[model samples]
Target chain A: MQSQSDNEYGIQVYNASINPAPRCPCVLLLDTSHSMSGEPIAELNEGVKTYFEEIRQDDFSRFSVETAVIAFGASDQGVSLVMPFTSCARVEEVQPPRFKAGGLTPMGQALERGLDLLKKRKREYRAKGIAYYQPWMVLMTDGAPTDQWREAAQNVQNEARNRKLVFLGVGVGPYVDMPTLTEICPDNRPPKRLQGLRFCQFFEWLSQSMAAVSRSSVGEQSVRLPNIDGWACVEA
Target chain B: MGKVIYSFGRFFGQAIGHVKAHCPAPGKDRPWCDQATADQMRGARSKTRSEPQLVFDRNGIERRLGPLMAKGGEGKVYPLADHQDVLVKIYHVRARNGDRLQTKLEAMRQMRPMLNSPLFGWPRLLVFDEAGTWRGYAMRRLAGVQMQTLCQPQLIAERLPHWSRREILKCARSFVSLVGKAHRNQVIIGDINPGNLLVDPQTCEVRGIDCDSYQIAGTTGLHTCPVGVPMLMAPELLGRDYSRVRRTFEQELFSVAIMLFRMFMLGLHPYSRTYGEDPVANLKSGHCAFGLGAGCRLPRGPWYKIWSHLPFRLKDLFIRTFRDGHGDPAARTLLEEWNDALDEYLERLNKGWFDPHLVPSAPKSSHYRGSDSGRRKGTASQGSRLFRKNA
Candidate 1:
């Protein structure tokens, strides 16, 4: 355990109060439903790796980037750290943990899990006296969830709408209702489509954006975002 | 009062050794002189010393002038000499807290690495002292008049009754270039009001001043952060949290747009029309100038009339930059737009449309002497209280 002033662990005590590192934590909630079994899965995995690789190359994203991966459909594919944000040098240092595809798409469970993780991290930050910006939860799906997702989706939507989390949803392939995804993300609109093989592009943006928020000295604003042009296509 | 008096006493204490070694007092031993009386005597001797007498002074520097100017919020600005003409800014520590001082000083220091010849002429910092109880610094001084005085209707009529279109645009471009330089360097001068900018009469050059609240990138390769005055701060910087990074080039571009709007429209803020009953409350409520009836005149029906005279896209971008730049920092104009608009504006200005010198204002030479020999009360307390040397 590092001392509060180490700044890496987000604990920063000043004038008798803990001044925590103001970092933004981000999670990529992916849908590996049965429909996404073959090429989509392979592309998604490659895209995920590419996301890590691309994010580390950015000037601002290196130290501030943290990642969590939660994939639905595969019972074994529980939410786990694709790459934990620490004082790590490169994203590749942490191997991209593999997620399988088998069960029904339980997006609610995945989203709930992702939110829980973010909440836990936030609590940790608060305990350590590190300040943090709004955490981002990005949901990507190919099909609708099999579980009673409305309640979970509504909960997620409420949190996102209230800005409790910076929520973004991306609909990929076909069968996933874009309008439904949009409804889930009322505050920032709904899931944008992964235009072409643009998962890399979206993740690249995510990494850079998170890094921008992270690398900032604990009290900076979350502005100057990367242009949304090259990433996901907004469903007009 | 006690702290000031204590600090004043300390100021003399530090200077005593330097004073004795370099310039001896007029009367060595005046036993009848009281402590206050002795302070007055020492203060006079410290002000004016022969060249050789000043050489051996600490670090070969000498006092150039006593406290000459004081702004309402900012502290006093004094002219000093240390092989160069410099302005010493002494902040009233009591008025500003430690965190604020730390924030301001750190932001200023972050810009140090990127300091080159700024287009609007940035004064280089010579020293930054937050050690002990007080905080202050010495910086290069620019030869200029306050922009606040220049555009005043009364001052304009008396100073230069007829400013040509070309001179006005050239001066406008000069101001833009300076702002452009700051953006390029990843700095945002949050206080972009006219009162904070200085203009040189001889060359019609502009320089940014009162930079204690400016923001820049952290020195250790951290993200670009936000800093500076909240009033002139971009919406994003002021919203949600205080940023330690510089506002994006896009946001800076928006600031440039607003600055130009003020310059061209005769110093009117876009939202000034609604600023009647309570401006502060409106600002807090996120109400900016865009579509309000009177304040919108510049960019709306009448203003767009003038804007239409300019190139299509450039005018559109200018309006969009400010309009979109209104409530959200995220939606501001990018650097590409600013650079393009600036290029267009410069080309237009260079075509003999405006005369910068003709802008209504007193020529700097009339009121501002490069060297103002104001009769300073030569007292030890005054001299000591004037500037705090960096440790």
Candidate 2:
């Protein structure tokens, strides 16, 4: 039988053969407003599915990456944490929720939900004394937020600026409020405008980038990410 | 991940002779070459060289390209319209510096040792655009389930359900031998990773792909492997420029060790079990956790059990390499040492000293009873593939 040995921190990591290896958690905060009901939602679902499929094929990404998905702009007028953080190793069991676009774009609430989930996940990591990479939040939206976002924006600034998180804001379509998205992002990194409805390329880049980062061993020096030019368009 | 595109110089180097001239279309006169260009068919001057539909092989056989098959950061790969078995890898035309890419390809083309081997996806046909600009080359397309699937537990259990310790070990040994063949030819698979290899599920025969990235020593000069992943990089090559450094065999062996470790230990990076820190840091510090064993903070998992179940000598080989080899290059385990250890392990397996269980969920570690099996003296260490009747 698999037995637990006392960890250096002396915490009881209660499990057998299920010891969590170092993890890299990333939360994808997506916009599913009513305007995205048709082609946009279909394309977005395909893209998210492609991301899972690509990460499933990669050994490094398969073993280490943990993904949670959160959606905003549902009928409830609040954010829905669609999927909690699950190991990519359990890829077959984990499915990207079939998102149906409905109501107000509560961008602020989604960011808060993503941040809260990340915080809780990090606590679990620390409790087990498990090593982890800085968390990543990829926020994609096609339209402007309907609610107040100043607190979420400030939290993103602090988390990203303090190096606790790698937050990226992606403007999905022409209707996006670039200024608000920029305000939410850190100063060094600006929100990237997604070209057309190329959600497939964006998620491929995300999965490939995560694979590289999770495989990377050092804290200093940034890991080289896949080129963003494929999906991100130049801002006018 | 910079986008690397080679510039096309006006001049074209002399093409090497083709191994076989593919007479693609029997009745059609030279397919791409004999067919009048759209401009010729139209009887008008071409529009800025137009799209290069025709590419000339070394034997001057002009071939037509089919629809694009696959694309990557560097370039796109296409298959010959008539010759379905042959695929061509063409670089993107962002051409900044063409000479280096040309020189590297030209040099590699001259290395004939890789020509007949199915083990490597070596560039076989030198393909040039109609303008005589070196675009890319063609190779026999290899078909197999990518080794990445074989490495992961969940995937392997589903894909190769019949795989056990014997199959995994046999595959690993075959991979080592293939790399040995490449090394003998002075070719170093500079970016060694599971992603770059393909495995035949039936025979567990591993085939290495992405030959363009190989570090090959040409008759003219050394064509250095320019790019590498950090996880596969050797210790001394940590901060060094991959383009400038000439990788030694000993250094290359370290990466071999890493890949071997992943294959044997269910895809765990040697440094991964580091008590909540950067795993690669152990590579730099020369303080690998495996050597410490019971003293180290090895979490309760299948990996720990595998380590515990590993034969003592094999564990020592890994320890010496990961821990001691960090400081001294010579301390790293060599291919022959691996062969020896594997030979012993095979014997132990054959004699039923241990169970032939290799899955991650392999039960708690009491299988190693090699002490009772007793050591076989003077067993010829040449690639031991023999298995006992009962095993």
Candidate 3:
């Protein structure tokens, strides 16, 4: 019998049995660039690790969750493939993959690369006859793109308008313009500010939301996302 | 009720909902959504279009091969094509999830001869295609039945009892040479029981099979299977301890010992299975099921008592391998007794001293002839013989 809760997540992880539907693929476009050095970057990096570890601990999330991190700091030229989540054969194999710091925040390149990775993973899921939800791109940045970023922002808006992907813009630290970020979304209030080193908390919420979405059968959606309280207040 | 006060909670909730409904703040959206989505969609479409086609039917493979023409693990062997009998091995879906690609790579890399000599009867790898979704490999099917069935003591006693002991030695010597060949090629035939070795009854030729479990040098790879035959497996291998790789040569020799024991003693698996309800359960218990049989009761001088006849240094090798290979696979090694015994046996067989009890053999039938231009000339003899034998 399919319980309503079980049906909510696109994946079911019970007794180490992972049932994954090709519902959605999510990538975290992290700013491991030079400007995010010291406390800001450490917290951000910690947040990224928390996202991976927390997601793996969840029974349902562990199955369907295929996470990729695109770091765009030191190698500012373009986004490089960090890890393909599909090869994590077992829950024990899923560890918080490490990343090094020191480079220009190439947010544009990271966005471009993250998208490609999600697409590749999604193709694999479909090939295996699994279903998927809308793919997601969670962009975490602290400053304006040192490289050309306007075009990348436009790409985000277009994807959001088309409902091709669910774009979440998170601006942490100082110098993040809310209006410019929200312009990346067709809908209003698209950009949100990071309350503190609470990026980890936000990732936890994101992971839970994804898990909830995957548990449900095809077409069923998740409502009542956890309250974005101290971790992240809705951007005014 | 005042309208402002009454609707305050609903108004605040709706406000928060409206805010949550929109996108979060964003500075770099250009490629994030548009370029990213486009790149992903393109990559996805290309991969989906380029999926590999299956050559053999997944379900039909096991049906043809059946439950291991002999005892084996969960995966079944299937014939891929009749062109000189190409066999494709399909790993069970459950087993497929293991580190198959890693295992295959290790198998290919480690099959090197440390001393750089010729291997006796090792099969050449034909194709290893991991790109295809389902894990499979195609290898040329070697000639002969599993040594276990072919060399059964009862069957040998019935069919070849009149045969001299010297003739048996030559057969055993050939097996030693085969192991030597495998070691020379850098392949550790991880499992060396009679069940894995195959031999042509008419030609007395032998070849090793089931190379998937074979590991490369430096790797602590051990063959995992549904139990029942742990007696033949080195103790360290059974436990899968990496320290056993240190006794690489000795461990290999231990396998040869077990193989020799099965052949010379006439089909007694050095250790027996518990005849348990579940064979896998018994194997996991890692203890010999049946007691050592009568053939091993011989005293000194006879090679059956070769352990005692062995030199102090060599005797210890056999003792360790015979004793520890199963539970402590690292402590065992291939003993020197095998080469010495094999050499002596082979020498006696070639001298005509081994042929006395047999009647003069009848002339073999003339082989069928065909146009020699295109078809493999010798393959037909081997292929047709196997097909007819299997059929």
Candidate 4:
């Protein structure tokens, strides 16, 4: 057990609090349903690693982006916080709990979990007086939700519509309920279909987009992210 | 990280040492400061990579770039295949302010002789492509990791293993001295962020990089520094068009204060709350975390004891600068004043006055008689819990 004397906030909190650049929180809501078991799961894991490295490469994003990973598929409760919110400056655990795909897809429950956590985090930031950019929640799925999700979907849509959240829904494979995902996302920023299993490229674009947003100066309008022609196939 | 090699670049008459960038093969995560030893690494590198990259020097002479040394959002830094001591910074194609960059670097090129000191990495000569289009400029590659790397404990332990608060103070002084030098030459380092300053751990000598963004009062016109890190900017400059608003020396002084505070206080922004508001917003609201009546709490980290340990003279300046100086740029402490305070602090530190622990422990309470107190206790295990410094 290390003493709190060296840095009173401990390692994790210190990493977050040490750099007082405004926070940019990103929540990754993943679909780990049984349908995603084979190659899809493998690609998803690799995509995540790519995203982490991509975000780390940018100086601003590395300082400002705090990310969390939540999956909905295997857990009895239908939602698992695979990774808690961590500052990109000191993100570790690159591999482990190697995302074994199983169980039914509870997309609604996971959305609820991801949204609640985001709300809690923002509240903490407000109470502690930490300034923050609008939060981002990225939803990636391959199959339809097996649980009651209308209410949670409504919340996601409402938050995204109000500009409180920057939501990006991605359909992993052909079976992904694109209509449902689109319903949960805002119209201006609709769901994008991943080209094949190009998880790496999608993650690369996500990281780039996050970085662009992080670099915007105070009072600046929305950032125009790099073109998504690399991996995403946005529906007309 | 292993088999270290130190290359000394000539700076004025002094030696500025920088560690080699250890790029066995240039991957994505890291690349910076020095070369991977020499040309030998390039012979092995070029074959496995894409076509040899090319650029044109100021004389329109074409040259191939060696292995990349560093890549950032704005541009990439690559070593010249021919010039062993020089590196080139090619701005990214999407540098939105590309027009401004060309004009500014051109204006700055005139001062190359005066700003010859490698400490500033001043552009030695402009570079162009075969089409005679401007590409970037050649500069003497600097030695050292970013000063921002030292601002955090984990990164500090990784890069500067044996560093103490004494070294931080030294770097701050060196940084201030460099800024003072630039100011005397009518150059304003408008973007004063840790990322812009590189520090050599071996010599504690700091070199200022990103000369392009420096605001210079050129003979033609005042070349503005359009790019700025919002958190580091003075209150007056926040949310304003950097290209339109002129940066005064007093504004630079405020930036210097923020840098000094961050240096002494473990990277905590002056406007930050423990779980704080963003520094930019705090600055806009005139709510500094230090200073009396700022209604800000000291960070839970090693900030308070470190704040308490600073000489009262320096402390008073920080308090006054953040509290009263937020609105009036002229009210900020002068660069010379900082130099004087740093001198006193360093002198007292050498004379065994006051606690100099990197994570200095706070005693019960007492009268502080300035640096003459010489109350420094030897490095003790005061708060070494989870922060197990591998050293």
**Model 2 per-residue lDDT at B235:** 78
Q: DockQ for all models, in order?
A: 0.01, 0.18, 0.01, 0.31
Q: Clashes in candidate 3: how many?
A: 62
The best candidate in terms of lDDT: 4
Name the top TM-score candidate: 4
lDDT of 2 by residue, B1-391 (tens): 2111121110111111121243233225332222212111221111222344777765456778875665544666666786544677888776314678667777776666675576777776567876777788777655445665554565565455566777777888888888888999999989887767877666777888778888988876898877676666677888778889888888888888888887777666676542445555556665454654323544334565455445567767777777778768888889888888888877876776655666333423333234553332112111011101111
Stretch of 10 with least lDDT, candidate 4 chain A: A7-16
Who is ahead in TM-score, 1 or 4? 4
Q: Write the per-residue lDDT of candidate 4 for residues A13-130, one digit (tens) a residue.
A: 3344345456789999888888889999999889898888867755567777888999889657578999888766765643423577888999888889999999999888766655
* TM per prediction: 0.40, 0.76, 0.35, 0.82
lDDT of 3 by residue, B1-391 (tens): 2121112233224322343344232223221223212211221221121222233322222212211221123344544332213344555556565664435533553343421122222222222333434455444345543464323332333233333344445567678777777566555666566646665444455666666555445364543332223445444445454323433666566567667655653443334222221222222353332223312222111122212111223333334455455566555554346677466435543553222221112211223222321232343332323212100
Give me the runs in candidate 1 sitting further than 4 Å from their true place: A1-236, B1-65, B81-84, B95-135, B160-162, B220-231, B236-246, B274-314, B327-331, B346-391
lDDT of 4 by residue, B63-95 (tens): 678777655557667877755456777876677
- Clashing residue pair totals per candidate (backbone < 3 A): 34, 2, 62, 16
Q: Rank the candidates by TM-score, best first.
A: 4, 2, 1, 3
